[model samples]
Target chain A: MTDGLPMRVTATGLPARVRIHEVGARDGLQNEKSVVPTEVKAEFIHRLAGAGLTTVEATSFVHPKWVPQLADAEALFPMLRDLGGEAHLPVLVPNARGLDRALALGARRIAVFGSATETFANRNLNRTVDESLAMFEPVVARARQDEVHVRGYLSMCFGDPWEGAVPVSQVVRVAKALVELGCDELSLGDTIGVATPGHVLALLTALNEAGVPTSAIGVHFHDTYGQALSNTLAALQHGVTTVDASAGGLGGCPYAKSATGNLATEDLVWMLDGLGIETGVDLGRLTATSAWMAERLGRPSPSRTVRALSHKES
Target chain B: MTDGLPMRVTATGLPARVRIHEVGARDGLQNEKSVVPTEVKAEFIHRLAGAGLTTVEATSFVHPKWVPQLADAEALFPMLRDLGGEAHLPVLVPNARGLDRALALGARRIAVFGSATETFANRNLNRTVDESLAMFEPVVARARQDEVHVRGYLSMCFGDPWEGAVPVSQVVRVAKALVELGCDELSLGDTIGVATPGHVLALLTALNEAGVPTSAIGVHFHDTYGQALSNTLAALQHGVTTVDASAGGLGGCPYAKSATGNLATEDLVWMLDGLGIETGVDLGRLTATSAWMAERLGRPSPSRTVRALSHKES
Candidate 1:
């Protein structure tokens, strides 16, 4: 509705409208110890969609064994068939089998991931970056044949838990491969949250130099180092439009061993508003959703902004 | 000696030493829900000084009726008498009465606070900004008479909780007044953690224009908005050297009525190291201090960097 223009109102006059992809229902819930009922996830997705999110990562179509927490995704997807909102509910599909499962559940949107570091790739997918890319090619092709829009995730773009600092070229190599393979958008994820603003800018500059369009790039950062939003600001300065965040700061990356949880959606929106970037998110609604999710999980949110602001209003 | 530099690593190539001030034993404990035993706080302060902090804020001398949390100041100061191991113990003194109490207890160093914003001045001390300065002048005058090295605190320099946005002129006006009052060093506090790098730069610029020496300025920031380290970077870029941080990010402003805790000393040290500033402190020891403090308080640290880095090593 804002004409896809970056210009925002009355804050800083920089172009606004940063697209936010709420990954709470899937990415947030996938690492929980308790089994969240399928109906609850379905309702969460509906509520998120209603809260003005243009992209809600609905659920991952991976096997029940690998992610026992998301075992309900199979039933949840089919039960929540009515899309009353306009956002894309893209599901994660690791390979041809996962893509088949998602398609069987009538999924029209899917995302594939390849780690930028060989260590992280093998650690997560039991394959190297090239091998993971090879595996994802056919999945992307199949999703395309079904007229599904494919997104790509490039993990460990900042640092790998096993191999240490991931070089910008490694990130570019995987991101370029994903972009060239017809993935519509590629998200660079700081899985361990160690990326400084300098690292973010350097990697983005490398990708920009390699001729990847900035428009096709998204950022997924963790607040482990308290640099997520600052890094986001740098990304925005470099023309990155899409960002992935979890409600209530849910979902720690168990793969990183003991890293901080994903960046909080409410916190991200709070910063974006201050910077005059529109996320089309209702702050009050987001806070409500996060509070609901926090209570369901029996945990306090990892979001300081949410906690601070909520207490002030009361 | 780190050449008395704010963040410079080598004092003109003489090898910089980073100075850490342990505020947790005092500021951190003062705001906690549980009143730690006098022995516990004394032990904590002793341990902190042993861990190599050159300056430790021993305790505050505010009215016992105002902050019952530190009412044990009567019992606490006597134990720390000649107890500092290679460190200077400074106590927070609010008024002439508080100064007299500290002087009675052999407190040789004291910190006095004056707010830039009228709203904060009223809320914190039930006085106007000028009225607050009037109160500070007599304390500084008395400290001079007692040969006390007075480090003045100018609260709400960047922003205020009740006042919303504070102008840089307002801050400079107060800072100039504090300097004129014979404060040896002035620490500007972002009381509610509402400062951005831009805000820091604006205030510093105005202070510089007002003939305030950067060498005489220190920064005290809260992490409520996750901008403390970044603002610290801006400070370094502007040549303001002294910094005040709580041991575990424990020093929340009681006046702000928010959990706007002080910048974690460990995290501050981490950033300073990355920026090549020589702060003579062991990161591991600082982390241990915060972690230990958190466990004692029955809570996790308010420091993102400390939590992330500590977990990574574990």
Candidate 2:
């Protein structure tokens, strides 16, 4: 309870350590209506790395026209060169061109986004599911050739806003394809946040059956329906170690003003810390960093843990 | 995805059906800074029952001096008499006087609140833990004599704000004392919202080893740190059937302006519905009810489900 920490009480059948794939700099800020200054984004990532987050997603290399909020990806990536830690800066590469741009700047880790369902694939990437996979094929191959750590982000793994229930087999097929295409890890995303614990376990079970090891899989859950933490717990129960969360739950849902987007990193840390799972992240520093970011965002943080901890400090 | 419903996918070894103990009318509003009118309170309860919640805690019969927000309990109980349904209206009775008042109003069910830690017991009840338990003994005895159902609410069962990391043994001692005093059910409360899934499972396991059956246990979790739903999932995994929640997350925390209170009913329903567990509650109707209450409270609901579903409607 001192410094807003939960008492450690380890559970059976869970990984001892979880690597938090901090997505605040990329996934979080991308959804912001206003563009954050490139320096601020760099400082945010630096703060995240300083708080002990090893893998901090820097920014997306998608076209500036599509995501103006992260238009300074070229400028922002260079500022993080002095982050000075064992932190891995992973940037999202949309295609071969994006990958080329990321590689020119010495990016060591890259992630390719794909959709599990055709409807989402068409909506998000403006291509069919197969077409999106085809696009990622060359990019992933190129990244693997250069010894880059490639993470395949499969969106709408459980339920789609348009397609409703996504078949587990469909997700497995794409996930297997991503791994086959030389991706080192796959991050399963509940895009609309419509998944439950059973669905989470079912999907993970299906992926394992399809030859994907638990160690190579991560989970990206949104808190749109407040299922993120519970779903994360279910994922942990299934031996998945990497969890994607936004610092201060930075990505607010674009569809609704009140709807939450990504799962808050602080909230995830609270659960992990309480369960005796180490994420190497400092809770107090992370909360302070998120609070600082929220102030910059001109809004209060959507993270319950951040708010609770910051309120205590105040 | 129509009407904002999650696709059903069942998890193994979970209860086929869960009975939701709706506490919005009592525990939720009791923490409100301003008192809601008696008519509005009665209407809210009716709406909740209409939405298929079987057990709705109506109000607390504690002295008005302590809880002025629910002081209209005397005026509210009679208004619910005309509520035609299978719904059970339970009320909190602080002492013998409160029990007499509820019994006179023909209350069929009553709950006595006790604190597991001596600090909380002394602060909340103005007596030692043993002394508070002794006070509840007569009230529980009297209620049982009248063939009334009794629920013992053990607050700060997980962690206390003043005394951090409450021991599992200490909670078990108070819980056993409550059962020995003739309580029919025990609601273990995470009053400070500091519990993780492992802590939840550990406590449940310890309670079971101490002779408290899962059948007689319920979980009441607060969302101060966003662990309520995850903790509830852990409790459900341990075979707990009754889960407590507040409609629209009605109880905002008194300690912090940004701190959330109860596990939101909408959020819980979203998880249970997706798990394919029968709760007999309509998600659409329940969301509408909570939204209506939130309007009356003049604040947006803290429930992620409520916001997501209500946003879809707008």
Candidate 3:
């Protein structure tokens, strides 16, 4: 133990650090058929943060009539403070009422949803695409007055199931609008799971040409067509830094019928780790958490990395 | 009809072509439970060509103890000519003896297997790395003298199951060796299917750095980890145009325990057609072919694209 070889154990860690925003508590629950207990959701966030996630989206304060699964958002966010303050838990707010509920729950960081395609906006939010943006303007302004950091979501960025393909111009328009509304960052969502690497390159390149900084862009991809990680790498190649991943691969847009699952956080971290990108996560722990949640959901963990590593390895 | 409308009608009238390379007769049959009858193999290839695969691989001519499934290679390849030359059948030849059998069967083209890693070479070919390559040199020379085109195969381009990670140096070394050995084209196989888009880029870049031309490198991927199509896109990005796909997702490497299936040709063609890549394939007909093969295999086809379009759309 006293030899120089033993003394020279410290090595420089991973080169580039990729920040993972865990969306399980919110995005995962949004698609659940079972009415998840609010206590379970709060406990889920606690376990996620304890497992080393810095940012976990806590809940969405939407109307109870529509998404009954997360209708108890009012009680969830306040209970998060009792859990701990180490993790920054964000809530999804749609309008002033939703924002008021989030603020009442003592939410500091929050996210709002927007759609690029007009057809999707009309079908989902009962408004045109521009009307949806206009609605979020005051919500962003109100959040700014409260000094809350807001993340804006631009869904149907890749393709809409109903509308077929959403144009990149629509994506650029929606993204620029969200940024102008004083949102801290914009996350693009491929609502339908029909995206490939080529579509990712074209969309991200168009966004870059539209003057949106890559650092301010976050990617929320579904592994439905099995191209999420590839799209993530394409965005990374175009300089996108922040990525959103669902823990245990628990993800599906509420409006999407076959919205299989999001990019697994475990797989993304695995790829990034192999590429020398430091994702400040314990993969072994993360895989365990995902497995536990999947068991709770009565389904196998959808993350291929989790299955491979957990089954065939230490 | 107006002149413009007539032009559109004519475009629709012309049959949509698809280069259906039937790997099942070789790639699929190589991993079956029972040794198929040689006439059954011919009938399968005939049915496949009738279903519209112009190119099909009939049998493998390896030593009997090595690959007992294709021990009837001498009987199988010759019987394929009785399919009335409807299918352009190619056979696998491990050495000159196999080549002699193939030439006796009048094989115009032959596929030679190589490995990008020494570990795979030992497992797959039963020889030390260079010894395997040295083994193929005279075999290729003999094919050249007979004016037979050799399609070289490099397995485990991304990784090998025995060895955790394959060095890019090994991939370039083997690819360059095959091309230099007079193989007309190369199809790099993701043997264990752990490849991601980044790994594909790294391997392709290494091949390019080693002065291997992109036009000759076709990707042969397995959907084991659900990364095949994304990896295919990475190859296309770097100008490696050709890709190898199995119909009805009929093949998985027997040595790879976790591999789900090969990349489905119908699915790949859907993405390629969407991206406007001229793969000379018909999507609808390919779906029918996949279904017919799936019925014969007594299993559900492994293509989601076909299932979705057929059940949902039709």
Candidate 4:
């Protein structure tokens, strides 16, 4: 209660420790209306690492025209070079050209975003699902040959805005394809945030049956319907070790102002900390870092933990 | 994706149906800054019942000086008389005087609010925990003699603002006392919203071990830290079938504007609907009701499902 921490009470059938893949810098910022300066973005990543997040997503190497918010990825990546010793800085690469730019800058880990649904794949990447997967094949192969770790992000794994509920078989096929692409890990994304516990477990079970081990899986849930933490709990119960969350619940849907985006890192930490699952992050410090970023964004944080803790501090 | 419904995938070991105790009119409106008109309050309760909420808490018979928001409880209670056939309109009775006021108005069901922590008992009721329990003893005795259903609410069961991490034994003792007071049901409240899934399960398990059946208990979770749904899921897994929620996530902490209040009914429905659990409520209709209430309150609803679904409707 002193630092807004929950009482630690471990649950059964959960992972002993979870690796938090912090995505506030890249995934969180990409959807922002205003572009953040390069220096501030670097500082945000550093603060996240300082708060004990071992894996901090840095920036995207996509064309600036597509995502102007992260156009300073080249300049920002250098400022984060010192943090390599403290955390894993993974940048997003869209294709072979993006991978070339990232490798030129000595990026050691990278992620390629794919979609489980054709509608989302076509809308987000301007290609069919198979076409997008084919495009990522070469990028993933080159990254593997360079000995760089590759994380494949499968978006819209649960429901699509245009396509309704995506079939589990469709998701399993796409997930297996990503695994076969030599990716070190696959992060299943509930892009529209409509997933629930049973659906989450069903998807994980299907992916496992399709030869994708739970150890190779991660979960990225949006809190759009306030189901992110519950879904995360389901995935953790299924033996998932990696969980992706944004610091301070940073992202908002570009189309819907009231719609929330990724699950807040502080909220996730509260649950993990209460479950007595080690994530190595200092919650108080992480909350402070989020408060600082919220100030720069000139808006209040969407995270309930961040709001509650910062309100207490004030 | 249509109407913001999640994919229905039934989870194992969960109850087939959950009865939501809608508290927007009583618990939610009590915390608002401005008092809503009595007619609007009546319409809100009627709309909740129309949306298939079988148990809608109407209003509190507490001293108006303490909660001026519900000062027109006498007027509001009469307007809800016609809803008796559609829903259980349980009013809150603080003491013998409140019980008298409610019974005179033909109320058939009532609830008495207590606290698991001594500090909250002293501050809220201006008496020791035992003193408050003694006060409710006669009121509950009279109600039971009159054949009126009674519910006892035990607040701060998980964590307290003044006393952190309340002992499970302490909550169990208080809960048992309430049940012994002839109350038909007991609601365990996470007053500060600091509870997590493990703590939730632990408390439920302890209460059962203390001879309190899961069917006789309900969970009232605040979304102050965004743990409500996950905590509710844990309770459901423990076989708890009753959940307390506010329409449109009403009620903000009076002391902290940014802190959320009770768990939103829409958010709860989204999860239950996705889990293939029956709640007998029409989600689309329920969301519309919340949106209407938010307009009356002059603010956006805090419920993620309401926001997501209403945004699409517009």
The top-ranked prediction according to lDDT is 4
In model 3, residue pairs whose N, Cα or C atoms come closer than 3 Å (at least 3 residues apart or on different chains), thus clashing, are B17-B280, B18-B280, B18-B281
Q: Among the candidates, what TM-score does chain A have in each? A: 0.93, 0.96, 0.91, 0.97
- In model 3, state the lDDT of residue A108: 92
Evaluated at residue A196, the lDDT of candidate 4 is: 97
User: lDDT per prediction?
Assistant: 0.76, 0.89, 0.74, 0.90
DockQ winner: 2
Look at candidate 1 and tell me the lDDT of residue B70.
88
Descending-TM-score candidate ranking: 4, 2, 1, 3
TM-score of candidate 3 chain A against the true chain A:
0.91
**lDDT score for residue A243 of model 4:** 99
**Every model: iRMSD:** 8.8, 2.0, 11.3, 2.0
Q: Which portions of model 2 show Cα errors greater than 4 Å? A: A1-4, A252-259, B1-4, B252-259
Q: DockQ for every model, please.
A: 0.18, 0.67, 0.15, 0.66
Candidate 4 lDDT over B1-314, as tens digits, reads: 25345889999989999999999988889998888999899999989999999999999999999999989999889888788788999999999999999999999999999999898888889889999999999999999999999999998898877777888999999999999999899999988888999999999999889999999999999888889998998889889999999999987444323336799999999999999999999998899999999999999999988888888778
What tens digits encode model 2's per-residue C-alpha lDDT throughout B114-168?
A: 9899988887888999999999999999999999999999988877777778889
The single-chain TM-score for chain B of candidate 3 is 0.86
Looking only at chain B, model 2 earns a TM-score of 0.97
Give lDDT tens digits, candidate 3, residues A1-314: 00110011111222266778899888977889998788778777887887788889988888888888899887777777864458788889989899998888789988999998887788789999889888999999999999999999988887776666677787898899899899998989987666655677677778888988777888898776555776676667667778899988887877765566788887786667556566677777787888778777888877766676566543
lDDT over C-alpha atoms for residue B106 of model 1? 87
Tens-digit lDDT track for model 4 on A56-144? 99999999999999999889999998987899999999999999999999999999999999877887899999999999999999999
B190 Cα displacement, candidate 3 (Å): 2.6
